[model samples]
Target: MAKFEILSLITSLLAIFVSCLALYRSRKTHSELVEFEKVHVKLSRRQIEEYEAKDAARQKTTLGAKLIDSGGIRLQVSNLGEASAKDIWIRIEDPDSYNPLVSGDYKQKIPYPSLNPGEDFTLTAFIPLSVTQQVYPIALRWLNEDGTQGDFRCTVSR
Candidate 1:
């Protein structure tokens, strides 16, 4: 072959080889980018979940109630929160539906001054003989240490 033709051929072959190398490098880089994106997405989701958990912990102030049958049915209210609650009050939601009579001194037992975490209070009440409802709704009101009021409504069942 002529010298010029051979050099031309070599040039063409070199161009083809360089293109293949570039293609392979691009594919590898793309695969690595895909893997990095997957890891980033996973980390982002984990961070979001952790932030939500922390937010809930900061916002939580829980008060719950239940009915117990020790000697008779009694309403037990509990402070299952991280802060102290004050001016706690409990009242029947529908007094007409479930007419309840306080067994003891109403003024002394109700509007409890304060309850700390894990503390509870109890009150005895008697349902009217004419009431037929199995469930009684009760409304609870309290003030947090920050002086913010919170309310919770729950059911007591026979």
Candidate 2:
């Protein structure tokens, strides 16, 4: 065979080998990037689910506190939620001044803990006549997480 022909053949073989190596490396890199992207997307989805779950549970509810006229101070508060509340607080305000008559300063986040569909849990906590008479035009305030608030006031005093 001629030297030129041999050199040409060698060059062709070298080119083919280089092309195969490049293709292999490109496929590997592509697969790695895809895996990383999938992981990131899955993680993001999980975080969104957590937030959405919380938000959906808290969606549109007449969250408020109230002082019932059932003799003693009947503080009936509602969370207006299906799922359990993580960190919920209820503050009873004295109408005379914006002072907390009672706060959810207990270890449990929610007073009811769980509020079912059309089912509300009420805690009838009675305060002595001294505390009750001291404050007038009572107000009920509900707080949860951040940026979640609701307020309601009692009817005109007798």
Candidate 3:
């Protein structure tokens, strides 16, 4: 009987020890999970802020081009961007072949001072009847409102 009592006491002590160990492990795991959640939330917020900033800058500048046949082939350059284009310059890749005559000026009358958003300009080009294709390649360079340089190239088709 004495031996049985001693064995029961030992078993009870072992059970208590196991319970304490399990409690300690659970608390440690919870603490680690909370720390990880904090870090993850901070990183997610920073990433969202960076993405929004880039999207805003991207929306600032956009350009659109169109070719119109109004009595003659006219190249219309429009600033469909949210901001204005400053010190805009237009250049024809091969002027001699296309024979572009803009606003009755034999020389290039490009390098307009500035073009506001939604504003546009027309350039007249006189192509010879011999050329089968009605496409003219043009290069455009300009400065943004933030003093950044922008360049674009497109083919004008009649």
The numbered model that scores best in lDDT is: 1
Off by over 4 Å in 1: 1-60, 101-104, 128-130
Which lDDT value does model 3 have at 30?
97
Question: What is the TM-score of each predicted model, taking all chains together?
Answer: 0.60, 0.41, 0.66
Q: In model 1, what lDDT does residue 94 have?
A: 93
Backbone clashes, each candidate:
0, 0, 0
What lDDT score belongs to each candidate, Candidate 1 first? 0.83, 0.55, 0.77
Better structure of 1 and 2 per TM-score: 1
Residue range 1-158, candidate 2, lDDT tens digits: 99999999999999999999999999999999999999999999999999998776565344544556666545555555443332335544444443433344333434344443355444445455455544445444544343365455653231
lDDT of 3 by residue, 40-97 (tens): 9999999999999886675456566667878887778899888888777777677665
Worst 10 residues of 2 by lDDT: 98-107
Give me the runs in candidate 3 sitting further than 4 Å from their true place. Answer: 1-26, 31-35, 38-42, 45-49, 52-60, 103-109, 128-133
Q: Candidate 2, 79: how far from true, in Å?
A: 7.0
Clash list (residue pairs), candidate 1: none
Candidate structures ordered by lDDT, highest first: 1, 3, 2
Q: How are the candidates ranked when ordered by TM-score, highest leading?
A: 3, 1, 2
